[model samples]
Target: MLTERWRETLVDTYGTPPIGLVSGQGATLTDEKGNSYIDLLAGIAVNALGYGNEHVAQAVYHQAQNLVHTSNLFATQPVLDAGAKLIERVGDVNARVFFCNSGAEANEAAFKLARLTGRRRILAAKHGFHGRTMGSLALTGQPDKQNAFRPLPGGVEFYPFGDADYLRQLVELNPEDTAAIIFEPIQGETGVIPAPDGFMQKVNDLCEEYGILLIVDEVQTGVGRTGTFFAHEIEGVRPDVITMAKGLGAGVPIGATITRGRARDLFTPGTHGTTFGGNPVACAAANVVLDTVDAEFLAEVTRKGDYLRQKLENLPNVDHVRGRGLMLGVVLNAPVAKQAVRGGLEKGLILNAPKENVLRLTPPLIISQHELDTALNTLRTILEELA
Candidate 1:
C-alpha cells in the first residue's frame, strides 16, 4: 500500500501515521479500514467549509478548466477578485494583498515588508509559532524548535503575550531600532490562548505612539475560524499589516500578506516575488470559502462555539475552556491532553493536543449540532473514565 511506501520513502519530519485516511465529508473522515471519526481539528483549522464542500469543489473545477497559473508576471481574474474581496472584508482602504503559498511564506513576506522600511528589529510575543522558515522562524518564540537552527536572523525580540506594559517598555527602550511588532491574536501552538481583554487595543496604541508597525498573524484565526472573518475585528483595532493562510483556501494551500495605508506601498515591483502564489484554482477555492462564510454562517459559529464551551466545562476532567468561537482549547486538570486525544480517537473521534495540558479543538464551522453533540458525548465519557 502507499502507506507502507510512505514510511520507507518520506522524510522523518512528520513521523508515522496513526491511520490511513481514505475520504472525508463535512466533519467526518473514514480511514482505509472503514472506521469513521469525527474530525475536531479541521486539519489544524484549515478546512473552513469542511471536506468536499460543493461550492469549493465547483470553484476549483471551474477555475482548473479556465486557467490555473500565469505566474506573478501577469494578473489573473481569480487572483484580482480574491484580493479585492479580501480588502473589502478586512475594511481597510489602504490595505493591499500579497499572495503566497502558506502561512510561513505570508509571514516571510510580512517580515520583508517591515524590513523594507529600513528598520532592523521586530518584536513578537513569547510562545508564538509563526513558521519554520528563516525569516518567520526568527519571529517565532519557541526555543525548542529553534535551537537546532541557531543564529537565526537577528534583531528579533520576544515580549510576554498580552503584557501591554512590558510591550510599552520594549518600545520605549528601542523606539528607533524597532520596525514592527508581530503577534498572533490567539496563540495557536501555545494552547489556543487569546489575547487578554484590552491587550490588542493597548498594543495598537503603543505601536502608533512609537511609530512601530503592528503585524497581526491571523493564520489560524482568520476566515471565520474564530467566528469573525479576522480575529482583530473583535478588538476594533486595525493592524498596519496582517498575515493569513490556513483556511484561506479551505483545504487548498494559499497564503496572503495584507498591508494597510503607507505600508502597502513599501514593496516595489521586484522587491518580492513568488511562484504558484495566486494560482487560479487556489484563489477560486478561497473565494468560495469566503462566500460560504457569510454573516449568517458566522453567527452560527458563535452559537456552536458557546455550546461546545459549555459542554466542555461540564465534562469531568476539564478544568477550563478557552478561546473564542470555533477555535477552542480544553484545559485538563492534569497533563492528560495526549491521553484524552488518544482516548477520543479510540472512541471514533479526532482531536489534537497542541500543548502538554491543552486539547485544541477547531471543528468545521459547518459542523451540525448533532455531530457536535455526538463528539461531545464521546468526550464526556472519555473524560469521566479518565477522572
Candidate 2:
C-alpha cells in the first residue's frame, strides 16, 4: 500500500500517508484504490482553482517546453510575468519581489530583510505560523515547535495576537531599534483566527511611528483565498513587506516575498538567492492563478463563503464558524474535530483538524455549489454519527 511504502521510504516528519492521491478533477480526488472524495482541505489551502485547471496546465506545459530554469543569473518571460502579476495584485507601485520555493522560504527572506534594518529585536504574534526554517521558525511564536530546535536564530519576541496595547508596550520598550513585526492577518494554522477589528490600523500606526518594517505573512491567506487578492487589504493597511505562497502557483511549489518602498530596496545583489526560485513552470502556473482569481472570481468566493458559513452555523455539532472566504474553521460543540476528519475521510470528504475542537475547511476556491452541498451533507452525517 502507499501508506506502507511511505513508512518504509519517507522521513517521519509527516508520519505515514493516510491516503494516496493519484489524480484530481474539480474538487474531487481519487485515492490509490480509485475511491473518490470531495477535497475540502485543498492540500492545506494550496489548490486555488482546484484540480484539472486547464489554464494552469496549459501555461505550465508551454513554459516547461520552452524553458524551466535560469537560476538567479538569467531571467525568463514567465518569471517576469509572475513578478508583474504579484505587483499588480499587491497594488504597490514600488513593490519588488523575491521568489522562493515555499512559504517558509518567503518568510526566511522577510527575516533577512529585518536583519538588514540593523535592529536587534523583532516581534511576532503568538500562535502565528510562519514556515519551519530556522529564521522563520524563530519568528514563529509557538514554543512547542521551537522547543525541539533549540538555539534558533535569536532576538525574536512574541506578543499576544490582536492585543494592540501589548504590542504597543513591546514596541515602546525600544521602538527605534525594533526592526520588524511579522504577523498573519488571519492565523490559519492554529485556527482561522482573524485579527480583531481596528487592530491592523493600530499596528500600522506603530510601525510608521517607530520606522519599523511591517511584514504581513500572507502565506495561507493570499492569492484570493479570503475573497480578496490579499487578506490584509481588508484592513486598509499597507505593509512594508508581504510573504505569500500557498495559492499563488495553483498547487505548484512557489513562494514570493513582496517588498514595498524602503524594504523593497533592501535585497541588493549577492544578498539572497535561490536556484529553483523562479522556475518558468512554476511562474507559468502563478500567472494563470493571478489572471483567474480576479474581481468577479473573488466576488463569487465571497458569496460562496457566506453561504457555507451560514450553513455551518446551523449544523448540529458546530458551535460556530470563523473565517473569511473559503478559509473556515468550524468550532465544535465537543472535542471531536479529529474524529470528524476521520469521519469525513470514511464518507468521501477530505477535511482537516488544526485544533482538537476546530475543523478547518480550505476547499478549492473554485469548488462548485453542488460540490459544497454534497460535502456539507456528508459532513452533516459525520456530525450526527459522532453525536
Candidate 3:
C-alpha cells in the first residue's frame, strides 16, 4: 500500500521506492514487512550517527519544543550555536557561515558567492555532481543531467577530476574571467573517486596563482565521513569557500557554506538570503552531531574503513576499491553492481550502486566491527552468486 501510494503521489524521479522502512537503530533497519537489513548506505551518508541516536533525538525534541524556525530576520540560539560550531570545526580564523537546508542550497550559495567576485566563469571537475538545482546543476560536469536543461546559467567549464595538468591548462586559458574552481575532494556520486596524490595541493596552487576562489564541495565527504572533519584537511589546503550538507545534521536536514578571508565579506546585507535556512531545530540537531564526532571517534572510523576496504580487496569479482575512510566504491570486474544490490537486499543487506559497475558504501560512523564483518560476508556471498 505504501509503495502504491508512493507511485501515485510522488513524481517518477527515483523510479520506485525499494522498501518502506518502518524503523532503524544504529546500523540496522526494519522494513514494513518485518524484514531486517544491515543498512550500509546510511541514507546516502546523511545518517552520520545512524538511526535512533538518543542524543540527536533529544536535541531535536527539546529544540523543537522551544523553537523550530525564526527565519533569518531574527537571531536564535540554536542557529547561532550551530554556526559557531561550524566555524570552530573549520578552524578558519576569518571564516563566516551561511546556513541553508540542503547540499544543493549550500552549493547555490557558493556559486552566488563566486559571482560576487566579479568573474563570470566557474571551473568544476568532470563527473563532479553539485546538485540538481539550476546554479549547482550548471557547475555539475555530468552531461546526462545537464543535457536536458540546456542553456543552464552559462560560464561554467569542466576539467578532468584528479588531473592537475588539465585543470592548470583550463585555469590558464580562462585566467582573467574565472571566478572560482569548485570540486569535490572525493567525487561521491560518480563513484567514490578520491583526489589523486598531490592533486589537491596543485589545484590550490593554481587557484592562488590565478586569484580564483577555491570552492571545495564537501557535501558527501564532510563531518567525519572521510576520517577527518573535512576531506581537504588531509591535504592541508585552505579553500576560500566550502559547501557542506550531508552528515552535518545527522539526517536533520541542514546545509552550510563556510567562507573565509576576503570571501566572507563578499556578501553583505541585501545580497543573499534564505527563508528556511539556518532553521533552529535543524541547527540544534547539528550541534549534537558536531559535539559527538570528536577526534577519537573519527580515528576509529579510519580504522574501520581500512578494515572494510582490505576485506573487500580480497573479495571475489571486486576489481578495486577507491575512496577514503568509510566512504568507499567497490569497482566490479563486470557490470553486475545492480544485480549485487538486488542480491544484497535479498540477503538483508542494504547497498547501493552509484554507477553501473561500482557499489558505493557509506555506512554509519558508529557502525560496529561485527556489522562491518557481516556486511563484507554478505557482499562476498552476493558477488559469488552474481559471478
* Each candidate's clash count: 0, 0, 0
Query: How much is the lDDT of residue 344 in candidate 1?
Result: 87
Superposition TM-score, candidate 3 onto the true structure: 0.99
Clashing pairs in 3: none
Model 1: lDDT to the true structure:
0.91
Q: Per-residue lDDT tens digits of candidate 2, residues 295-370? A: 9999999999999999999989889999999999999999999999998889999999999999999999999999
**Which order, best to worst by lDDT?**
2, 3, 1
| Cα lDDT tens digits for candidate 3, 1-387 | 578789999999998787888899889999999998998999999999999999999999998898877899999998889888888888876799999999999999999999999999899999999999999999999999999998899889888999999888888886999999999999999999998989989999888988899999999999999999999999899999999998999998899999996588999999999999899999988999989999998999999999999999999999999999999999999999999999988999999998899999999999988888888999999999887
Off by over 4 Å in 2: none
Stretch of 10 with least lDDT, candidate 2: 85-94
* Model 3: ten consecutive residues of lowest lDDT: 85-94
Q: Write the per-residue lDDT of candidate 1 for residues 1-387, one digit (tens) a residue.
A: 557877999998998777789899989998888899999999999988888798898899988888888998888889989999999998876689999999999999989988988888899999999999998999999999899998999889999999999988988887998899999999989999999989999999888887788999999999988888899989898798899999999999999999996478999988999989998899999888877789998999999999999989999988899999999999999888888888987999999998778999999888988899999999998888888
Q: Each model's TM-score? A: 0.98, 0.99, 0.99
